[model samples]
Target: MTTRVIAVGGADAAAARLAACLGGTVCPLAQRRFPDGEHYLRVLGAVEGADVVLVAHLHPVDPLLVDIVFLADALRELGARQVGLVVPYLAYMRQDRRFQPGEAVTSVSFARLLSRSVDWLATVDPHLHRHAALSAIYSVPALAVPSAPAIARWIRAEVPDAVVVGPDEESGQWVDEVARLAGCPGITGRKLRHGDRSVEITWPALQPWRGRPAVLVDDIVSSGQTLVTALQGLGAQGLQAAACVVVHGLFEQDAAQRLQAAGASRLVVCNTLPQPGLPLIDVLGDLAEAAARLIAPRQG
Candidate 1:
């Protein structure tokens, strides 16, 4: 069977890389918004009877979700045999449950929406809080690709005498894993978020590694407050801010500036989103591998 990779808008580079890895053709998607605020999308190539891999990063989830559904339905309508999704940064995953009464479980709801659109799904380092895995929420075959190995490799190669630090207790596991792979010491701090832009961070005892370069690792850096707070705390403890590593760098508003102001020496992120300026650690290989497994013929 012929496998074709489709790069949705904003995911062209990632899709191209995946296509090269799979040795498949790249299908382009033409998208635009109507004057009335409606979206219009069209697959620019033939997909009849072909296995389609839709490469997208559902970051600003709203319009992208619409685009995804439209694309998937169009492919199925055009007689595509299978549809698989490779979402590098799956959004709306942070809201796993309802904190307030009458609040919606958006994680499950979003999972259901995507599951209905494609046969299988793959994502990189989704913000999996409260849920153990993506499969716990998604009804379809869902795979969460870890960025720790790649991040660790980058850290090992770039940062000397690196001491991995997790911004909060929630990131302890990921921080420990990266440290283990990089063969460095790891510690996690405490974080208290009062609002979107307001946060407080308390670092653990860093007296042992005071002069060592500290790399703060987190799954996502949305508002960048946590990272800013951590960077400030690290500076106060006499540790040099080597770098801030994140899987999904949703560096909103003044995030980049504030990080630098707080004494972050460098900022690195996985290529989950289209970040132009910062260094992007490639995760396309990992995404393609996972997608290949899903689209491969089932063993007897």
Candidate 2:
């Protein structure tokens, strides 16, 4: 089926790339804020009887979530048969479980809200810390596409003397996979989380991979505390100023400046999130592949 791809907010560029991949038409959308700061959205192209894919970069999430639901509903009201979402960097997965009393589990809630709003969903390597997969929280046909292969390829082509270093134990397996694919050795560090911005990392002995250039790898780089600490730890071991590779680059506030000051030689991230002046590793192929698979012809 020929699908119609519509992007909300700052996802027009990504939507264009995915549309090219899916062999879909890029549907025009008009969105703006009112005097009182309320969102307004309208689908300019016809979507009747067509499969519509909503492309969204859900960082700075709350407002986009609101806009997307409205836009999805608009598509349905305009006679669209199905609505799917392609959120490159999905948000709210961090709060999968409630550690404190009376805290809201936004992961499940966000999934519920999104599942009801769209028919199917696809995202690039969502943070699945507690739940095993997207099926655990989302009721719709949703999937997380892996970016390891793409990352590995980038590392092989770019960083010749790369030694993959995972900042924390949570990323041990992930780091190993990337390193194996990149044909480089990998090591993981232990982390004791004091808070969101505060973390204590225990670096493993650096004797084995001492002279090689380090590349700190992780799925997400929000606030960049973990990365900052990792750079310092690696530098202390005489491993030279290391580079950073991340899937989602949510460098909030002064995080980017901080990472630079912390001695990160290079900061590379996937095109999952739109940011200015940052080198992007293309993951649209993976996203398009997964999204196309999910929306493929379903036989009765």
Candidate 3:
């Protein structure tokens, strides 16, 4: 029972790395749009009777969702035995619940849509909130890969005399874990959001870490406003040097620039997504191991 790794658009490099790790072949998927704005997807290799792993990072969620559906259905139609997903950055996770009346739970709906196509799912550090785990919404066997160990290792190797800081209270757990692993002090700040791009961040007492480098860690940096606010607050506190570390760097538009402008000394992200300019820490080894386990038969 051989498993083949297929890379969807924008996921080619990570998929190739995963294929090498899994000792599987890389299958290419091509996409095109019709004149009226419909999508056409084609799997360029034979998948007949083979276990297939579709690697995609669900940023730019709408089009990628359609692509995954079309590709998975196509593979099944071509007689593929099992189809699994390796989504490094699982989107639609933020909308786990409705904030107002008459609103849809998009997370559950997205999970159902994905569950219909894949036998099992694997992703790196999904933005899980208001739910304990992926199993809450996704019926399929879902694995949430932790990038903390990897991030900690990167911090240890790169940042010296670093004090780990979480941008908001919600990130305290990850910050504490990473700091423990890196053998550094950890502190979390308070965040109040007014709108999509408006955020207020108040840092905790950093008297103990004054003059030491601050490493701000978080799961996702979508709009980067949170980080910008945090960095500005730190600078006002006389913390001159700061680094931003994240699992997913969905730096929308000039987000990276904004963070830099706000005085972030360095920006590092895991290779979960295709971050072209910033430094990337490899997470493919972890993802490949998870994918391999998903394809393996369970021992009862």
Candidate 1, which segments miss by more than 4 Å at Cα? 298-300
What is the per-residue lDDT of model 2 for residues 1-300, given as tens digits with 9 covering 90 to 100?
668999888799989988999899999999999999999888999999888999999988999999989998999999887899999999999999999999999999999999999999999989998999999999999989888899899889988678998999888867999999999989999999999999989987898777789988898888999999988988888786567988899988999889989999888888999878988899988899988887785311
Please identify model 2 stretches exceeding 4 Å from their true place. 298-300
Model 3: per-residue lDDT, tens digit, 127-235? 8878899999999999999898998998899885788999898888789999999998888999999999998988777787778888999999989999999888887
* Model 1 error, position 21 (Å): 0.6
Assess candidate 2 and give its TM-score to the true structure: 0.96
Backbone clashes in model 1, listed as residue pairs: none
Question: Model 1: which ten-residue window has the lowest total lDDT?
Answer: 291-300
**Which 10-residue window of candidate 2 scores lowest in summed lDDT?**
291-300
> Which TM-score value belongs to model 3?
0.96
TM-score sort, best first = 1, 2, 3
Once fitted onto the true fold, the runs of candidate 3 whose alpha carbons sit more than 4 angstroms away are: 298-300
Per-residue lDDT of 51-72 in model 1, one digit per residue for the tens? Answer: 8999887767798899889989
Q: What 10-residue stretch in candidate 3 is worst by lDDT?
A: 291-300
Full-model lDDT for every candidate: 0.88, 0.89, 0.87
Distance from true position, residue 260, model 2, in Å?
A: 1.7
Quote the lDDT for 171 in model 1.
93
